[model samples]
Target: MKIAIIGTRGIPNYYGGFEQFAEFFSVYLVEKGHEVYVYNSHNHAYQEKTFHGVRIIHQNDPEHKLGTFGQFIYDFNCIRDSRKRNFDIILQLGYTSNSIWFFLLPKKPISITNMDGLEWKRSKYSAPVRQFLKFAERLAAISSDYLVADSLGIQKSLKKRYGKDSTYIAYGAHPFDNPDISVLDKYELQPENYNMIMARFEPENNLDMVLEGVVKSGDETPILVIGKHETKYGAYLKGKFGQYKHIRFTGGIYNLAELDSLRYYSTLYFHGHSVGGTNPSLLEAMSSQALICAHNNDFNRGILGDNAYYFSNPAEVATLLLTTKKSDNLQLVKNNFEAIKRDFNWEKINGEYLQLFEDCMARHQSGK
Candidate 1:
């Protein structure tokens, strides 16, 4: 089947979870005898070129710096070009609020969108933007032939908000083989020496809570926070905690191997995201076999099952840090790994998407 992926900052996954999801699924779909094309941001120099048997179509506003506006331009250009292509299905990863072009597309081409997380609930957005996002989400839910929810929590949200039935396909994680010990020494990290938190410095991620909790805990163990220092919140975090000897802020380690090594050897993985559904970092941590401690939420519980430790208050987090034994959590990590392999492996998850696309196409053909 010929398939096209729209509404993501094109692949190889340098950015967010959607990009990574597109990257993994595109490659898998191509290998499975499906022709795939990704909409590349025009700002990227390589946007005009094809990579790994997938065609790359460039969007007018490629910088992706324009936030929601950029995605609008991307979807417009994609829809315009899509009219000329003989694609069986068009998969959109996010809500396209600015582009009315999607509504113009030929209804015969099956439209499947993964609604990602609840973007409107994010604390970083302004009141107006949040309201706009809520409206956009409703439109996207109603317009699409098929909708995908990344977690059960998100599926529930969709049902409650729009009364739309959504397919629940969890995000998949790639397991890291035995990481190189030399890589650990390079970061001055001995196994179990530090707690690790890898996420964007956004308000919804609850980074401040993690930092304050760690400081209050007074545990001698260092906390290594790794993510991009590009945002205003990121700069604020660095300024606030850079002076502390126990808090090591490595701003965005781009090297995949190095990041995997850090995750594999970490004593405990800290996930404080209070919003969003099935965060990719948390899944990656579980895949790395790190003993997980996450912000207590239905979303995290749904993903981690009984294999994770959760905390609601900063005081509770501090208590866990001081009390939980590193060695005792090995079984928990092992159990998480087992569950991830069984349920969240890309090989299995991607096939579900492929089947959904096929079903959507079949339904369209049958005039259903």
Candidate 2:
């Protein structure tokens, strides 16, 4: 089957969840003997060439760095090009406001979109932008042939907000094999000495709350926060927390080996995201067999089940940090690892995606 993935910043995934999803799915589909193409942004510095046997279509746009406007332009150009490609299916990872272009495509490809976390509820967006996002999400749901939600919580949100029934297909995490031991020396963190938090330094991620909680708790365990230090929030976090001897802010380690090493060695994983549906980082940390103490939310609970710890207020988190025993948490961590292996592995997820694609194509052909 010929497939095209759209609505992301492009490959090599230097950014967030959807980009990484696209990268892994594209490569996996290619490996499975399917022809796959991805839309790459001109600003990404990616060559117009095949990567891992998957074709990359470079959409050149100079204004592609201008936030929402750039995304609009990129999506419009990608849709224009997609019409000419005659793809069997087009998978959009997010709701692009310019998605009206999909309606103009010649093939009228079976469109499948992953309705990522509730963008409208994010604290960073202005009132107008949030209102616009709500409308765009409705349009995408009504227009697309299939809508996918990464978690049941997101599916519920879609139904409540837009009156749309979405398919629940969660994101997958790749398993890490042997990690390099030398990378541990960089953080001066032994295998189980420090608590780790890996996520974007955004307002929704609640990094400040976590930091303040740690400071208030005064748990002797050191904390290491890893993420891209590009945003204003990230900069502020560095400015405020940089001097602390117990807290180490390692700005964005991109190498997979280094990331995996951190994940595998960390004693505990701190997840403070109050929004979003089944965060990729949380799932990955669980897969790595780290004891996960996630934000108290239905999404996190659904994924971790009863095998993980949850905390709402800083006091609860602080209490957990001080009271939980490594020996007692070991079984829960092992259970989470077992669950991930059984349910969230990339191989299983890729097969599920292919089946969904085929079903969408069949339904489209049958005039359903």
Candidate 3:
């Protein structure tokens, strides 16, 4: 099967979740004797024409110069390019900037959109932008040939909102094993002596609330706040929490090995993403055997399933940090690791995507 993966910055995963998904899933598709192409932004670090066996299509992207509006132009370029590719299927990873171009998508290919989290509900966007996102969500739902939800909560939400049935396929992660202890030396950290979070600096991530909880915990243990601290929100968070001696704002670390080692050695891994479905970092932390304290929500709960700690607010976050012990939740960590291997493992997820693609192709061919 010939497939085109759209809606990500591009492969080798220099960015966030969907890029990671494209990097892993597209390689797997190529390995299985299928032709796969991933759309990359012109400015993406990986400038090669292909990654592994998968083809890379670099489209003109001006997001840096134009800001968020640049993404719309990038998506338009990609959609316009896809019209001539004659792909069997185009798997769109998200709809925020791309859904508006649904009318421009080629008619020959079956379009399968991975309906990502509730973007309209994010706190960062203004009322008008949120309303626009909601409308884009509807356009994506109605325009695609099929829909995919990354979590059961998202699937249910899609059904409730648009009466659309979507395939429930959560994100995937590789189980971390044989973590290198020496990696901790670079960060001047010892085993189980610190806590951490690895997520983009966004309001919906609840970073400030989690940090406030950490401050309230009064443990004085150094908590490494990973992710880039150069953004507007990041600077605000730094100004808010920099006075706390234990709160260290380490900029983004993209190395998976370093991140895995960090999580494996941490005392507590706080996942404060309240607005997304099945966050990739949460899965990574679980796979690394980190004792998780996730934001209380259906998405996190559906994935963790009593295998980790839950917190709804700053107070809950403080309580968990103050009282939870790594020794006590060893079994919970083990259970989450097992869950990663059994359910969220990459091979299993890659196969599921393949099956979904095949099924969609069959249904489309049959005119069903």
Candidate 4:
């Protein structure tokens, strides 16, 4: 199958969730003998035309100048190019900045879109922006050949709201059994001595709430917050909590090895994301055996199940920290790790994606 992947900054994924999905998914499909093309921005660090067996198509992305608006132009170009290439299928990773150009997508190729999180529900966007996102969701439901929801929660939401039946396929994570502990020393960290919180600086992530909770927990153990701290929220968090002696803001560590090491070594991992379906970082934390203290929400609960400790307010967070035993945390960590290995395996996810593409193609051919 000749597949063209769209809606991400593209492969070798130095960015976030969808790009990471494109990187692994495209490579796996290529290995299975499917000709895969991933769309990349011209400003991407990796300028190579191909990575692994997957082909990369670069386009002019004016994101630097135009900000989020530039994404529309990028998607327009990608869809325009796809119309010419005659791909068997086009996999759009998300609909945030690209759904407006759905008319440009070729009619011949079956288009499968991953309906990511409930974008309109995010707190970061203004009321008007949220309305736009809601409209974009409607457009995506109408335009795409099929829809994929990463979590069962998202699937149910789609069914309830749009009356659309979306395919349920969660994101994948590589289970790390043996991480380089020496990397921990570089950060002045040790196994089970510190806690970690890694997520983009956003209100939807409950970053402020979680950070305050950590501070209120009053533990002498350091809490390492990892992410880009240049945003307005980031600055707010620093101003609010920077006085805390135990809180260390380790600004945006992108090294995969370092991330895995931190998760593996940390005594507890706080996943504060209250928005989104299946989060890639949360999955990675599970894979790394981090005893999770996730925000109490359907999305986190769907993935973590009984294997994690949940909290809503600072008081709950404080209580959980004060009461939870090390032995219990260890047991939960082991269970969560196994769950990740069993359910969120990359190999299993890639195979499901291939089958989805094949099924869509087959249905398209049969005019069904």
Candidate 5:
């Protein structure tokens, strides 16, 4: 099958989850004898025409000059060019930027979209923007031939709100049992010596709440907050939390190996994401065998099952930090890694996507 993947910054993934998925899934699809093409941002560093047997097409992205609006232009150009490619399927990773142009999309290829998270509910966006995101979600749901929800929580919401039936598929991770502990030398950290948090500095992600909770705990255990700190909110957090001597902030590190190793060696991993279905970083943390401390929500509970400790606010977070120690999470860590291997493995996830694509294509042709 000839497949064109859209709606991400593209592969080699210096960005977030969608790009990471594109990187892994596109390569795997090519290896399985499918012709896969990934649309990359024109400014992305990897300029080659092909990467790992998968075709790469650079689409213009003026995000630097135009900000969020540039993403719309990039998607427009990508869809326009893709219409002429004669691809069997169009797999769109997200719809926030492109759903408005759904009418302009080609009618020939089967369109399957991955409906990611509740964008409208995120606190980062203003009220009007949130309404626009809600509309976009509806447009994408109506426009696409099929919907892929990354978590059962998302799947259920799609059914209740949009009255759309979606296939429940999850993001996957590969575990590294024994990564090099020497990677911690540069950060002045040691294996199982620190607790950590990995996430973007967004309001909805609840970084402030977690950090405050940690400070209140009064446990002098080293807490490493790993993520980019350039945003306004990020600066606020650094200013707010920097007074605590044991709280260290490392601006985002994109190297998965390094990040995963950090998580693996952490005394505890805190996941504060309040929105989204099946977060990539959370799974990576689980895969790395970190004893999980997660926000109490359907999405996190769905992923961690019964193996994680949940927190809703700073108070809960502080209570957990003061009460629980690394030794208490040994069994929980083992259970989480097992969950990743058994259910969220990339082999199973990619296979499920392949079958779903084939089914969508068949149904599109048959008018089912």
Candidate 6:
């Protein structure tokens, strides 16, 4: 089977979740005797023509200069190039920008879209932008040949809103076994002596709420704010929290090993994402044996169950940071790690995607 994955900045996961999925799954497909192609931005760091036996297609990406509008152009270029490739499956990772160009997608390939989170619900976007996102969601749901929801919450919402049937496929993570305490040397950190949250500096992620909790707690224990802090929101957060010596804003660290090690060693990992399906970072935290304190919502609750503490606001976060004991939550950490191994391992996730592609191909051949 010849498959092409679109809708991410590029592979090797320089960005985030969907790119990570593309990096792992595309390589797996190649290893399994299938030809896989991943579309990368023309400016992506890794400018190679191939990666780990998978073909790499570099498309013109003007996002650096045009901002958000450049993403639309990049997706358009990818789809236009894909038209001539005759791929058996074109797996789109997200639809915020690509859905508008669905008409240009080749008719021969089966179009399968992974409906990500409800982007329209994010507080970061303006009202008009949110409305546009909602329209994009609807377009992607109806335009694609098949839809995939990364979480049951997303799947249910899709059914209720669009009356669309979608496959419920969650993300995956590898259990972190190599815990090098030495990785903390550069950050001047010790094991179990700090707390952290790794997420984009967006309003919906509740970063400000969680940081406020850190301040209110007044524990003075170091709390690392992972993610790029160069955006306007990032600058605002830095200005707001810069006085606190413990609130360290470490810019984006792409090394998975370092990130997993940080998660493994942190006393309490805060997950404040209020929108999104099974978040890849959250799963990585779970797999890395981090004792989590998540934002109380259906999405987080559905995944963590009773395994971690839940906080709805700054007050709850403060209370948890002040009172929660790492020793008592050992079992919860164990449970989350076990969950990753059992259900969210990369091998299992890769196989499921392959099966889905094969099934879609068979149905297409039979005119179903």
What C-alpha lDDT, on a 0 to 100 scale, does residue 98 get in candidate 5? 91
Candidate 3, which segments miss by more than 4 Å at Cα?
none
lDDT of each: 0.83, 0.81, 0.93, 0.89, 0.90, 0.94
Model 6: per-residue Cα lDDT over 170-243, one tens digit each? 99999997888999998999899999999988988999999999988888999999998899999999999999
- What is the lDDT for 239 in model 3? 91
User: What residue pairs clash in candidate 1, if any at all?
Assistant: 42-62, 43-62
Cα lDDT of model 3 by residue, 135-238, tens digit: 99999999998999999999999999999999999999999987999998998988999999878899889898899898887878889999988999998999
Clashing pairs in 6: none
- Ranking of candidates on lDDT, top first: 6, 3, 5, 4, 1, 2
Query: Which candidate leads the pack in lDDT?
Result: 6
| Prediction RMSDs, each to the true structure | 1.7, 2.0, 1.2, 1.2, 1.2, 1.3
Where in model 2 is the C-alpha error above 4 Å? 63-65, 96-102
Model 4 lDDT per residue over 1-368, tens place: 99999999977988888988889899999889989899999899999999998999999899989999999998888888898888999999889888988988898888899999999999999999999999999899888889999999999998898899999999999999888889878878767788888999999888788777777878768889899999999999999999987889989998887799888888778899998899999999999888899999999999999999998988887776677654566888889889888899999998898999888888888889
What count of clashes does model 2 give? Answer: 0
How much lDDT does candidate 5 score? 0.90
- Model 6, C-alpha of 100: deviation from truth (Å): 0.8
Off by more than 4 A, model 5: none
Number of backbone clashes in candidate 3: 0
* Candidate 5 residue-wise lDDT, 273-313, digit = tens: 99999999999998988888999999999988789999989
lDDT of 1 at 90: 86
Clash totals for all candidate models: 2, 0, 0, 1, 1, 0
